[model samples]
Target: MAPFEPAALPELLPLFYRRLFPHGPYGRWLGYGGVVKNYFQLREFSFTLRDDIYVRFQSFSSPQELERELQKLNPYKIDIGAVYSHRPQEKELVFDIDMTDYDDVRMCCSSADICSKCWTLMTIAVRIIDRALVEDLGVRHRLWVYSGRRGVHCWVCDDVVRKWSPALRAAAVEYLTLVKGGAETVKKVNLSEPIHPFIRRSVGVVEKYFEAYALVGQDILGSPESWEKVLALVPEEHREVLQDEFPKKRDSMQRWELLKGRMERTRRQGTAGKSAPCYADWEIMLQFCFPRLDINVSKGLGHLLKSPFSVHPKTGRISVPLDLQRLEQFDPFAVPTISSLCEELDAAGDDAEQEEGGELEPKRRARGRRAWRPTCGSLSSLWRRWNVHGEESCGGGVTCKETSEASLPPTALFLLRGHCWPQASWCLGTRRLQPNPSAPLNPFPPFGPFLHKKH
Candidate 1:
C-alpha cells in the first residue's frame, strides 16, 4: 500500500465521491425496507467540511438525493445518525473499539500507532465479540468495519436491535465487558472459580494468540520493568518468588510457564486464601487481551458513528467493511487509500493494449464501479444476510417461498425496494445532485445523554 498523503484529499475526494462510493447498497442497507413511514427520509446525516465546518441534521428524500449532495459537498467525513420524531426513534446497536484503550497492555506501539504484531488485538476482538453477538445474543446480521485509523466498529442490524433501549444496550455492553477500571487500577480483571461459559469461550479465543502475541510479540515479561506490571496481577506471596525467578528464565515463554506453574501449584495445594483468586492466570490473559469498548458509543441511540466507506480525513483511508470469513487474514495496512484507488482506476482506463470496442471496453466503463467492488461486495453480502425473507431481485419482482437470499445473485438483491435495475450491472450510474444544506443544529441536546466525541 502507498503512504497516504493528506494534502491530496481536496483533489482525490471529488473523484472518490464520484466514482468509488458504494451508494446503491449503502442506500439499501440504511433504508431497512422502509418498514416505518419515511424511515430513510427521517434519518440524519452529518458532514464535516475542510475547515471543520460541521453540518448536522441533513436529511434526504431518497438515496439518489443523498448521492447528489455527497458529490456536491465532498465532505471530509460522514457520520450516520438515527431517525427521529421528537427523539431518536431507532438506530442500529453499534460498538466502537479503539486500540489506544489497550495502551497499558500492548507493547509494540503506543497511542494511535499499530503494526502487524499489535493488530492481532483487533483480530481477537472481532472473533470474541462477533461470536458472542451471534451465538449468545442471537443476532443474525452484523456489519464490521475498519475505523480507517486505529480501531474497529460493529453495527448490529437485526430488526429487533434497532428498537433496543439504552438500558438494554448497557446490559449488552456490560455482558461483553470483562476488563474494567482505569489505568490506575493495578488488576483490571478479577476472575473466580466456575467461570461463565462466555468467559471460558472468550479465553479460548485469547489463548490461541496469547503465546505469540503476549509472550513473544509483546514480550510482557522480558524486562524487569515490564514484568513488574505482570507480577502485580499475580498473588502477593508469588510476586517476590516470580521476581527472583524471572531473570533466571531464558525467555518470556519460559518466564510465563514458571508463572503458570506457581498458579497451578497453588490451585492443586488448596492453600490459597479466599481473597486470592485461583483463576488468576486466566484473569491476566483477559486483562491483557480482551476487547475494550467505548461504552458511551454503544449505549446511546442518538450518538452518530462514522458512516461505512467514509474516508478518514487525516489518513485518507476508506472505512471499508470486514468479511468475517477472512477475519484472521484482514490487514489494516493493506486497505486501499483514496489516492491508490484513483490511480488504479486511472491506470486501467489508460491501458494501451486495449481496442476501442473490444471486450475491454465494457470493463473500462465498469472500472469506476469495480474500483470499489470489494466494498460493494461486502455491502451486498450484508444485504443478503439482512434480507432473509428471500424476496426476489430488483429485476425480478416475484417473491419465492423457502428460497434463501444467498441463493439469489447479490447484485439483484442489492436494491431491496424492487427498483428497476440492470441484472448484469453492479454500477449505480452517477447523477450530479445539488442539495441545500440544512441549518446546523446541536447534535447533543441538553436533555439526553449523547456521545460527544466523533466515533
Candidate 2:
C-alpha cells in the first residue's frame, strides 16, 4: 500500500466507503425505526474536501445514496450536523467539547499535541458529563466518538434531547459550566460556605486526579517559574507567604499541602474581610482539574460536529466510537489509519482464500469453517474474535453499537468486513429469525439475508 498520507485520501476514501464502511449498523442507528418519513434525509452531512474546501447542507435520501455520494466525492473529513426544520440552515440542538479549550490546565501537551497524561482530562470530562446526562436530565442513548485529533466529541442523541429548544440547551450548558472568568480575572472558580451538591460532586471528581495530574504530572509548584502561576490564584499577602514556603517543600505534593494550609488559615481568618474570596483549596483544584467545555457549541442549535468514522486528514486516522469501560486505558494513537485497515483487510482475505483453496468441500461446509468475503469476515468468526467476556463483543452499558471501547480491531473488522457493503447482515444471537417459508426467500430484504443467530 502507498504511504498513508494526506495526499492518499482521495485514493483511499472511495474504497473505504464502498468496501469497509459498516453500513447496516450505521443505517440502523440513524434510521431508528425508519418511521419518520425523510428521517435520514432530515440529517445534515458536512464534508471537508481536498485542499481544505468544506461543503455543507449535503443530505442523502437513503443510506445507499449516502454510500454512493461518499464514494464519489471521497471527502477528507465528514461532519454530522443538526436535523433541521427546512434547510440545514435551521438546525436542532447539539453539543460538542474540545480539549484545546482546557489548555490552561493541561501542561503535558499544548494545542494538537496530546500525551496520555493530558488525555485523562478527556476521560474525566466524559465521566462527569455522562453521569449528569443520565442522572440529572434522565437522558438515554448518547454516542461518544473520538475526535480523530486532539479531543473527543459526545453526541447527545436521546430522542427528547434532539428536540430540546435553544433555551433549554443554553440552560443545560450554563448548568455544566464552572471555572468561569476570562484571562483578566485571577480567580476562575469560587466556592462559598457549604458548596452546592453540584460543586461537591465536581470536587469528588477533581480530588481523584489532583495529585497524579496536577502535582506530579504537571509539577505546577516545582519551580519559582511554575509555582508563581499557581500562587497568582491566591490573593494578596497570602500569595507572598505561600511563595516563600513553597520553595522549601521538596515536591509538588508537599507544596500543595502548604498551599492548602494557607487556604485553611485564610478561611479561619473569616469572611470578615471583603478583599479575600471565601475560596476553598478544592475550588482552585476544581478550576485547574475540571473539563473546560466549548459552551457555544453546545449552546447553539445549529452547530455541527465531526462525524464518527470520518478519516481525520491530518493524522490519517478514522474517528472511531469510544468504549467507556476502558476509557482510562483508551489511547488515541493506536487507532488504525485508512491505509493500515485496508492492508489488514487484504492480508486477512488472502489468508482466508488460501485456507479455503486447501480445504476439501466437505470440510469447507463445516460449521466452524469461516465464510470467505473480500473485506467482511464470517459472522461466526466475528463472534469468536469479539469474545471479551463470556458475552459477545456487545456490552450492555454502551449506548453506541460498538461492542468495545476501542475501534474495530483488524481482527474483528477483517473478521467480518462484509462483502456486500451496506447490505451486510449478521446473526448476532442464537436462533435465526424464522422468516415465513411462504414469504420471499430473502427474509431480511434490506439486509442481504437471514442470519443464523448463534446460541
Candidate 3:
C-alpha cells in the first residue's frame, strides 16, 4: 500500500475533527470532573498551524466550543499542556519522556526516525518507568501516549501526582535515572550492587530483552571495534587480557559467551581481587541495555506533550495510545493516519462525499456521522467486552456515560492500549487493567507484577 500524503492534512483535518474526533471522551478526560474551576476550560492546548506557526494558551469553556474552534482552524498538530491554576501560561506538573534523548545508547535511527529495531528500547523504558510509577511513587493513573514520531509520553494524572510540586517531580526523575555520564564517558552504568530495588527490577527487565535487542539486533560484539568498546567497560588490565582472547571467538553470540566465561574464570581464580574492578558480563549488558531517559522532560513540571490522538503534521499519523498488554507487539506503522481514516470515510460512498452540500449544519453532521460509523464498526468487540450499553454519536454532545465512582475513566483503556477509539468508549465493569501475564518466551517468562488501577 502507498503511504500517507502530508499535503492533504489541511483539507482532511477539519472534517476529521468535526465528525471523527472523539471530543466527548477528550472533554471528559480533561475536565476530569471539573475538580477545579472549569477544569477543562483551565487546561491549556497548543495548535501547530501550517508553515509551523504555533499558537498556545488556548482553552475552551466546553467540548463543544473546543470542537467548533478545531473545525474552524484545522490545526496541523495539537499539544496538551498541564492544567493550570488560571491562564494556562502558568504550566503545572505533567511528567513525560522523549526517546530522542536515548540516541547515544541506540545504534539505530537518530532524532525522529524509528524502526522496530530501536523501538524495543522504548519497551524497556516503558517497563522501567511504569513499574516505578506504581511501585515506587504510588501513582495510579498513568497514561502513556505515542508521540506520533520517535517517542512516548507518560501522563501521571493521579490527583495525588498532579498536586506534587515541581521539586518532587524533579526528585522523581532523578530517582529513576541510572545510566549516567555523557557520550564522552565510557562506563555509564556503574553497578557496585546493593543496587536499589527499582534498578534491580529494571535490570531484570533488560535481561529479558538484551540478547534479542543487543546480541542479535544491535550486534554489540559483532566486530573488533564493537568488542573493544564493550571491553572498555571492563577494567584496563582485564580489557587487555580479553582483547587478546576474544578474537579467537567467532560472532557476537560466541564472543559474548567468551567474555562472560573469561570474567567468571578470572573471578573464580580470585583475580577479581587484583588492582582493578571487573564488571560481570551482566553489568556490561545492563549498561548497554538500560533505558536512556530524557531527564529534562521528566524533571520539568512545565513541559507540554502532544495530546494523545493528535495528528502529526509531517507524517499525517495519529499520535495514538500505547497498548501495554501487547506493548512488544505495538507497531508504529500500524497507526491509522488522519488521511487514511478520511479515506475510509470517503470509501463509505459519495453519498457522504456529497453530503457536504448547503444543508443545515445539523443535517450535514447527521449525514457525516452515519458515514463514519463503518470505520468504527471494528470497535464493537471492544465495546461489547467493556459492556458499553447505548450507541450514541455526538453531533454536539460532550460526554461519555457520565463517568461514576465505580466506572472506569471514559478514555482510560482506549488511551491505555492506544488504538481503540470512538473515542468515548469506556470499561463498564469494575475489573482493573492488568499487565501481560504471558512469559517473554526466553530464559524467563514475562515477569512484571500485574497492575490493576481503578478509575
Candidate 4:
C-alpha cells in the first residue's frame, strides 16, 4: 500500500531471486543441495520481515513460529535456474547467458544501510556498461527499475542490433567483467596507452568517473561526467552522506599518485624501455639470482627495479643480473662440474694418488666430493643428476670421486697415467709413443675396425 517502496527492499534479495529464476517463472529450477520445501495453504501473501529487513513468505500464524522456521534456512546456499523458451511443436530454445556478467552488478545497499564498497563497485559497473553501449557497441541502452522491490536492471534492446555472435558476446562479457575487480585493467591500459581506440575511450570514461566521484564525495564510478550529473540531481543534505559512503578522496588520490610515481620510476630506471615487467617478474628474478637464497629485496631495490631488467628493448631479454651483490646472496659457483674440476686437478698435480694425500688433497677431495658425475647418456638423466639429486654418490662413503676414477675409460686412463696432455698423441695398450706429430689424444680407445694407427 506504500507504493511498494524501493528503498525499503533488501539489496541482496533481488539478486538472489534473479539468480534463482533468471529466465522467469518458466525457467527450470535447480534445487539447492540441502534445502527442503514444505507445501502450505496461504490466505494472504504475508511478508515476514527479519531484523535485517530481509522479507520472506511464511504460512505460520505466530512470529515465534516464523522465526523458528527461518533459522533452518541457510542463506548462503541458494538455488540456481536456467531459462528455456518453449515453442509449441518446436524444439525448446535456451538463452545461453554467461552468469559471470552478473558479477559486475553488485549489491549497493544491504537492507537499509549503505555499503560503500558495493556502491563503489555498482557505480563502476554503470559507467562501464554506459560507455560500452554508447561508444563501443554504438547502441542505445537504458537503465530500468525492477520496481525498486528488486535490483536495477539494464535493458540493451536497440532495434538496430538484435543478435550477437558468440565471439562478440564473449567480448561484451569480458568488458563487463573488468568492472568487478576495480580499475586494474583500466590502469594498465592507461599506462601503456593502448592502441585500440574503443579501449582508450573506455579508459577515458573510467578516469573521468573516478575524478567526478571524488569531487562529489561519492563512490568513484567508471564515468566521471555521468556521476557529476547524478550528483547534481541529489539533494544537498544527502551530499554529506557520501563522506561515509566512499573511500576518502585524498586517500584514493594518494594511492593513484603512488602508483603513477612507481610507473614513472620504472620508466626512468629503463625498465619500461624493455618489456613491461609485472610483480611476478621481480619474483622470478629474485628466485633465479639466488637459487637457494631467501631474502626480500630492499624497498630501495624494489623502487629502483620495479620491472625486470632486460637486455634488449625490442626483444626484451629478461634475466637477473649475475653481479657480485646477487652472487654473494647465493653461491653461483656452487654449481659443480666434474670435467672442469678434473682439468684443474690435473693442472695442479701429476699423480691422483699423491694429490689425494698431500696439501692439494683437501682441494682435490673437496672438488671431487662436489663434482657432478653423469651415469646415463640421456638428457633426462643429466637433468635429474644435475637438478633433482645433487652430487649423488654411487659408492658408499667414497662419493662420486671413487666411482668416476673406477669407471674411467682405458684411453682416458692411458692419457692420465702417461702424463700425456689431453691434446697430446699417445697409444693406449703398449704405452708406446706414436711417431705422428699432428695426432691429438682421443679420449675413446680404437676397437677392431676403428683401430687405425695415426701416421
Candidate 5:
C-alpha cells in the first residue's frame, strides 16, 4: 500500500464510526497528524483548521519516524470498549492502565510477531477476564473480536458484566495483575499449590506448547526414539515429518553447538526488526545445529517459568524444591484418583446387586480397595534404629520392617480394616492375624480414629 496520511477523524469520523463502531451511539475521534501537532504548537485546537494532515504510513516504518513527523501526537492508548455512538448525557467513565513505560515499537513488533512473551501476557489477560467474569462471578459471556492491526479488542457481551462500573473494572484488573504476579512467583516458589487458579490453567497451556516444541527439537536432533516420544505428546498437525524418516543419525554435542553459533550469527545479520523472519531464521539455525534433533527455542524460557521447578537465581538451572506431598494437592493425577475410586465403588455396588440376583459373581472384587504402604519408618524409629546400628549393621541382625512405628506399635494386634489390610501390611508383619471382615479394624486405645472399631 502507498504511504498515505492516516484519515482525519473530523473529515472521516462518520466513516470511522460506520466501520469500527457500528453499534455505538458516539465514537471518540483520534487525529493522527498536524491537527494534533498544531494543537500543541499553538496551544489551541482553533489553529488546526488549515493544517495539512498526513494519513498514510508504512506498516513496517519505525515508530521513531512517526514521532519525528508528528511533533504533537504520540501514540495514544485507546480503549476500544470506551468508544460510544452518541455522547452519553450521563457521567461517563473509562478504564485505562498507565502506559508510560511501554514502547510502541516493541508493543507493535511483539503483537505482530506473536512474540511468546507478549502472547503469554495477552493470553493471561484473556484468562483474567474469563476467570473474573465467568468463573468467579458466574457471569456467562462471549468475547467478541476487534480486527485491530496491532492489538486485539475483546468485547464483553454479558449484560451483567457490561454494566460493571469503572471501579469494578479497575478492581478486576488489579486482581488479575496480582494473579499475573503470582504466576511469575511459581518460578520462585516451585510449589504449584500456591499458584493462583487462573495462573495454573495458563501455565498448563504453556507447558503443552513447550512439550510440542521439545518434540520438534527431538525430531531435528535425529533421535528417532526421543522424537517419537515427543511426537506422541503433540497433535498430528505439529508433526512435520513421517515416523519412519525421523533422523536416526546422532551428531556430537559440539556439532550442535557450532550449528547454534552459525544460526545466531544469521539471526543477528538478518533484519532484526522483522519478527516472522527472526523466528524463521531461528528455526533454520536450529535445523543446522542439530539436524537430527527438533529444538523449539522459539517458545523460549517462558515455558520453564510455568513448570513446577524453580530456576536457581545465579546459575539459571531449574530444580524441584517443593516437597512431593505439597505437589500432590494441585496434581491432576491425584485429583482424578478420587473420582476413579468413586467410579470403582459404583461398580462394586453393581457387583453386589448381581450376586443377590443369582447372577454369576467373580471371586474377587473388580474394584480394588484403597491402601497406603509405608515407604519408610517414622523419624523416631529411624533415629532409634540408627542408634542401634551405629554406622554399621544392628547387632540383632533383624530384618528392618518398612512399617512406620508411629502407625502400629510392636505390642498392637494387627487388625485388617477396609482397605488398610494390604496397605498396612508393608509396615505390619505378615504374621498378623486376619480379623472378621465386618469387625472393626481398631478396637481401642492407640488406634483411636485412624482405625475402624467394632460397635
Candidate 6:
C-alpha cells in the first residue's frame, strides 16, 4: 500500500465511500429501528468538504438516501448531530476523552501527537470508565470508538441512558471525573475522608498501569523538575523531606517509594495539616493518570461529535469501533487509512483478474462492485455484527434483530438470563415474542405507572 497522504484525500474519499464504507450498518446504527416516527430523518448530519467547507443540518429521509448523499458529497469528515425534536430524549449519552487533556502530566506526547507509551492512558481511561458504566450505572449497552486521531468517544445507548436529563448526564460525568483544575492549580485532585468505592475502584485500575506508565515509561520522578510536580500533590509537611530524598533515589520507582514512605509515616504520626493525610497517595495517583473528560460533550444534548467510520480530515484514519476484549493489544498506528484501503482493493482486484485469466477493469468499476462490502478484517468483523441487525432467523420461525448497540461484542450484545444466546432478539420490532423460561424475574413486581412490569 502506498503511504497515506492527506493531500490525496479528495481522490481517495470517493473510492472509499464507493467500496469500503459500511453503509448498511451505518444506516442501521443511526436508524434505531425506527423507534419514533421520522426518528432517522429528524437527526442531523454535518459534512466537512474540501477547502474547509462545512455543511450542516443535513438530514435524510432514509438510510438509502443517506448513502447516496455520502457517495455524492464525499465528505472529508462527518459529524453527527442530535435529533431536532427529541431534545434530551433521543440522543445517546456520550463522553469524549482527548489526549490533549493530559498535557500537564503526559511526558511522551502532547497536543495532536501521541505515542504507544502515552496511548496507555487511553486504555486506562476506557477500562476505568467502562467498569463504572457497566457495574455502577447498570448500563448494558455501550459503544466505544477510536476518534481516528488522539482520543476515544463512548456512546452509551441503553434505553434509560438516552432519556437522561442534562443534570443527570452532568452527575454521571462528575462521578467519573477525579483530576480537576487547570494548569495553574498546583494540586488537581483533593480527597476527603473515606473515599468512595467508585474512586477506590478507579485507583485500582490506575495502580495496574501506574508503575509502568508513570514511574517508568513517563519517569515522573526521574528528574528534580518532574519530582517537584509530584511533591506538590502531597501534604506540605512531607514535600521538603521528599524533595531531598528523591535525588538520592536511583530511579522513579525508588523516588516514588521515598514519597510514599514520607506520606505514610506522616499520616501515622498525625503530623499532617488540615488536609486528609490518609488519601494523599491515592490523590497523587489519580491526579497524574485518571481519565480527563470534556464534561460538556457528555452533558450537552446537541453537541456534534465526529461520526464513527468517518475519515479524519488530517490523519485519513477511519473512526472505527474498538473491540475492548483485546484493548491491551490495540495499536492506534495499525488502524487502516482511506489511502491504504483503496490500494488494498486495487491489489485484490489485480489478483482476482489474474486468477481468471482476464484483463483488469477500471479501478472505479472494480471497486464499485464491492461497495457496501467489508474490505479488511476489522471492518469485516464490524460488518458481520452490523448485518445481524438486518434480520437473522433464530429458528422456530423467530428472527433475531439487533436494533441498538449492534457494534458491541457478542457477549455484551447478546446475553439472556445467565447464558450466551448468540441469536437473542431485542424487544423492539420483533413480530414474535416468546418469553425465555430462564429469564430472571423483574424485581418491581408490576406496580405503578413508573414501575409497571412488561406484559
Best by TM-score: 6
lDDT of each: 0.72, 0.63, 0.63, 0.28, 0.27, 0.70
Tens-digit lDDT string for candidate 6 (161-263): 7778889999999989888889898788888756699998999999999999999999998998888778878777667777777778899999888777756
Stretches of candidate 2 exceeding 4 Å from the true structure: 1-3, 87-93, 264-280, 359-369, 372-455
Report the poorest 10 consecutive residues by lDDT, candidate 2.
443-452
* Candidate 6: stretches off by over 4 Å: 86-89, 265-276, 358-455
Q: How well does candidate 4 score on lDDT at residue 101?
A: 29
lDDT tens digits, residues 295-323, model 3? Answer: 66655545677787788777877777665
lDDT of 6 at 354: 56
Write down the worst ten-residue block by lDDT for model 4. 25-34
**Preferred candidate (TM-score higher): 2 or 3:** 2
Tens digits of per-residue lDDT, candidate 1, 41-66, equal 88999999988899999999998899
Model 1 Cα displacement at 344 (Å)?
1.0
**Cand. 6 Cα-lDDT:** 0.70
TM-score of 4: 0.27
Off by over 4 Å in 1: 269-277, 357-455
For TM-score, candidate 1 versus 3, the one ahead is 1
> Could you tell me every candidate's TM-score relative to the true structure?
0.79, 0.79, 0.77, 0.27, 0.27, 0.79
Local distance difference test, candidate 4: 0.28
